[model samples]
Target: MINPFAPIGRGVLGVLAEIGRFTAFAARAAASCFAPPVFAGQLLRQCMAIGYYSLPVIGLTAVFIGAALALNIYVGGARFNAESFVPNIVVLGITRELGPVLAGLMLAGRVSAGIAAEIGTMRVTEQLDAMTTLSTDPFKFLIAPRVMAATITLPLLVVVADIIGVMGGYLVAVNSLDFNGATYLRNTFDFLENQDVILGLVKAAVFGFIIAAMGAYQGYNSSGGALGVGRATTNAVVGSIVLILALNYLITAFFVE
Candidate 1:
């Protein structure tokens, strides 16, 4: 007789196994970051690719998010004659929460998927195997640099996003909301604290590690061929976004309390 609980057991076991594999992969990647024979060139390239190339989308997303956030806050505040708090709330939301979370989500879609596809293709084509035969550690040569670069660059991106996001709120507040430009700027500046910025950057760094690790892990384990690579790319993005949201809450809770 077929056991009714067998399917549930299998699903739970599969999830546990996947979690174990991912944990081990992340540990190895973390260890590889400090190992010798650093790939300076690859690291630099990845920094440029992950950081510089990511600015346009990050900027646009921040600006739009800030603008929309300002508008919503203003409308909500107007209901209770609290409209003057727009600048304060906008700045706080951008730096403390929205900026890092949005940036991480955007990067998970862009960087994680790209990494998976690039590495997955390489895997399917046996390039990783070739590197192995040539005495090159794929972890050192490929994964480590990408992982380290992502970790290093994301905080910088969050800083820029925070600035642009505040600027976005500033523009809307001045042009449409008819607030005194100087007062709006002053409110924003005064309300923003170093702690908020630091918190966001800390979140960004953790999100970065998750993004790169998920991508490389999915790509490295991918089999089959083109179809499999495509599937891995999808999984990388999905996994990164899930982890990003979950960790954001945990980090915020830890620091906020």
Candidate 2:
């Protein structure tokens, strides 16, 4: 007789095992981050790769989202004859939620996949093994710097995104929506509190850490050959995006409640 419960039990065990492995990997990576000989150069390079190179895509995404958000809010507000509130709402939405979340998601797609592919390729090519043979710790040299860079740089990226997004909204409101430029800017600036921006930045940092860690974890553990590397890359992006969205809600709830 086939035991139906056996399949369910095995599936649960597999999930638990994966969680355990990921936790262990994260712990080791965190430890390596602090106990390092401090690879400053590698860290800087990663900062450039993860933060600087990502600005164009992030900016473009923010502008379009902000513009669309403004348009939507204006249309919705018009139904209630509250269209004047568009600027206030737009700024609030961007700083409190959309800015960090969108930036994080974009980076997850770009940075996570790149990290996973690079590290996965090294793993399959035995370059990581070669590093070990040369007395270089892979976690410290490769993983730690990337993780640190992401954590540090993402907030800055979010700040830029926030600025660009607000400007996008302003342009649309003033030019297309028949909004007074001065009033729009004033309402945007006046309505936002410091805590809103701070919370967004905090979320960015956490998202950044998750992005780098997931990429490194998936790549470091991948086997097989080219196929395995591709799988790791996909997993890295998917995992980072899922974690980012889940954490965003939790963080928002914490701040709101």
Candidate 1 achieves a global lDDT of 0.95
lDDT of each: 0.95, 0.94
TM-scores vs. true structure, each candidate: 0.98, 0.97
Best by lDDT: 1
Model 2: how far is 35 from its true place, Å?
Answer: 1.3
Give candidate 2 misplaced runs (Cα > 4 Å). Answer: none
- Among residues 3 or more apart in sequence or in different chains, the pairs in candidate 1 whose N, CA or C atoms overlap within 3 Å are none
